[model samples]
Target: MFIVMVAPECAPVAKAGGLGDVVFGLSHELEIRGHAVEIVLPKYAGMRYEDVWDLQPSHHDLWVPWYDGTVHCTVWFGYVHGRKCFFIEPHSQDNFFGRERMYGYDDDALRYAFFCKAALEYLAASGKRPEVVHCHDWHTGLLPVLLYEQYAQVLGDQRVCYTIHNFCHQGLTSPEVLWATRLGRVDHFLAQDRLGDDTHHGAVNPMKGGVVYANFVTTVSDTHAAEARYGDSACGLGHTLHRYQDKFGGVLNGVDYDVWNPETDPYIPAPYSASTIERKYLNKEALRERFMLRKSWSPLVAYVGRVDEQKGMHLVHHALFRTLAAGGQFVLMGQEQKHNGINGHFQHLKDHLNNNPDSHLELSYQEELAHLVLAGADLLVVPSLFEPCGLIPLMAMRYGTVPVVRATGGMRDTVFDRDHGEHADDRRNGYVFQHTDNQAIDSALQRAFGLWTDYPEDFRSLMLNGMRADHSWHRPADHYLDIYEHIRHK
Candidate 1:
């Protein structure tokens, strides 16, 4: 079957967070399942055009009536995990994506609306009618809206499935989007939930419209699905998600072992497998010596991901101050990417942490460094207030680095607290805290440290257990195949 994937971000091209990881991981697995998959994303200025310059040129310019403007669509073709990937680059005059950030835009609705319409038109023109048009996140929410409003009659046979990687980034359809994209018929979108909750108290909400319109909807994890069904973790779209609970579900994300495997990985210093467990320790000692970490007494605490508030930076920062004071070796491998503002967020963070850079603290966003840190660390910390299937902790677990994460969404589902007194065997993956506070992080860190220092034998056992666990996409890809077969008729 031919699958069309539309996302706002992808890896090795343009990325800000886990959204890119999901796009690359899932697309790779889908392709492995004998399905021809293609991806569509905006040609942001930050995209690595040099890497994908070989994709054949296959796009054109189209104008929307009354908008007094033209939108340029450039098509690029490639393969990810043996699956054909087609990427779309949308050119905007006002530097829509020219900046070095992924989010924070007032005109996002207008941009992606034109993007969805253009992709459908391109599909029709190129004679490439996919069996499923899989739209991801609120960024591509307009696909279902446009399909029902415009493309359904012409491409009525194709089914549309929308995956909500993050429901918060809605492409709100305001008067600008309604008029600029040439979507057609404002009354049709407005009268009685035609466009779902794109308008809430005069404000537009595009994420809600996706839940209402898609043939099938999926979150990143089963726990996230449950949280979204309730009013807790929906990020203001809980009621909307609850309304569509029947068709909504979650697929616990899987890691790409090809990129994360310790044995074959080129990033880590000492390559080791499940059998050569002792070599990973050498990597840890090498990591300590390379980073100039002097606190060999305490268990090394590590962090990797976006250094933003949502990642519990407020708490992680506080815990860092406290944990380091308590004689713990702390290493953070991350970088901050501010969307669009007069001032840069990275500069602000550097000004705060620049006082000392030679200690256990290292701030670099390079992908290879992230893999090295994961392989070398004793405990990986992910204090995300809300995580959409975090990949770092999973990678950490694969490398025998225990994770200490906040028990929320995917974090709650993946990391298990072995010290919780029951299911000790199954719960030996990592440490977890429920409350999104520094207090919780402090306690979890203490418990993880306790296991690392006090119970060296048990800690080694836990590491061995983590290495043996199967977190790969092998099973999840089968589940996705089941989903595809179930929705094949649509």
Candidate 2:
């Protein structure tokens, strides 16, 4: 199969979140399976140039239509994660992807719209017709619309598999923004069931357009698919998903063991596998020393992710104090968005801690620190209010660190309660909570702490179970291949 992935981010080169990890992991796995996989991403100014192998200009002047005129783009080709990749570098005065950051710009809608068009222009001009044009997130949501409505003659009738990683960010923009995409505002395209944003008057929802036009739509997990269709988690797109229920489904995201495995991890102080789990404590000691934490036998609970409202930052804050109250050492390594007020709260909490011996909070994301935390900590907390598919918990488990997550999205699909499931004795890998409240998380934590404190052997068993579990990309890649084959035939 010839598959081409058009996404905004790809790991180790340009990444903002789990979306990049998914793009790289899935593409790499597909290539390993003997499929010809290629990726197309914008050549953002801040991308890690050193990671791209043999990057050279494929096309110097690929003209792409803009709002009123045309802008030429430089198409570059390279290999990332051992798969072919093409980068579209727009030579426009607007500086679409020339910013220092990957996202959170005022002109993101217009930028991505231009990117979608430019990616198609590159593919068409390069004479490549992929069997599956996998579009990811709202960043490439407009690709399916452009491929079918605008570039069908050149790009052919390729099957588009639109994967929605985060439904909350639907790329809702002014109706006038469609001009940037060169997708004119015709009544057929502006219909309520198509690209129109029914909830927001005169707005265009790119994610909705992808879901409607693509042959198949998938979220990160089966439970999240259900939530997006029947629950309020889709942020007003539930009806749209429910309307296209026949073609929409979910597949749980997978972790790239090449980067996350404890046995081969170079970031951790001590590398240990499930059988030699006793040596994992060396890393715990190293973490305590690195964070200036007082040495203690109590469980070390860690939280590593973005600190935001949707991530249940309130629960994270509550967990920090609760962990301390329960005689556990707490370590948090996360980045906070400035717009959210949680940064101030965490800053104040940090000041109050005053370098407390049992607790440490770092307000920024350091990839190395995350690996150390996961490998060293006994428990990893993921109290997301709504998670599409969290990769941290999966990576944490691979390091033999038991995850304590709220039952939502992929967390529900992956993390079984240590004491609740029918065959939990054998299948349970972590602790699961039901609600988004502090009490619910506290209850799960106390059980985890109790198991570690009193029943040491059982705690070891739990950790071993998590370490033995297979959360790799192999199965999920096969699931995606099945989707591609199904769409190809249909």
What local distance difference test score does each model get?
0.73, 0.90
The digit string of per-residue lDDT tens for model 2 on 164-258 reads 99988999888766767767765666789888887887788889989988999999999999998888989989888888999999999999988
C-alpha lDDT of residue 289 in model 1: 72
Error of 2 at 103 (Å): 1.1
Clashes of 1: 1
Lowest-lDDT window of 10 residues in candidate 2? 179-188
TM-score of each: 0.90, 0.97
Stretches of candidate 2 above 4 Å error? none
Clashes of each: 1, 0
Residue 474 accuracy (lDDT) in model 1: 80
RMSD of model 2 against the true structure: 1.3
Error of 1 at 382 (Å): 1.3
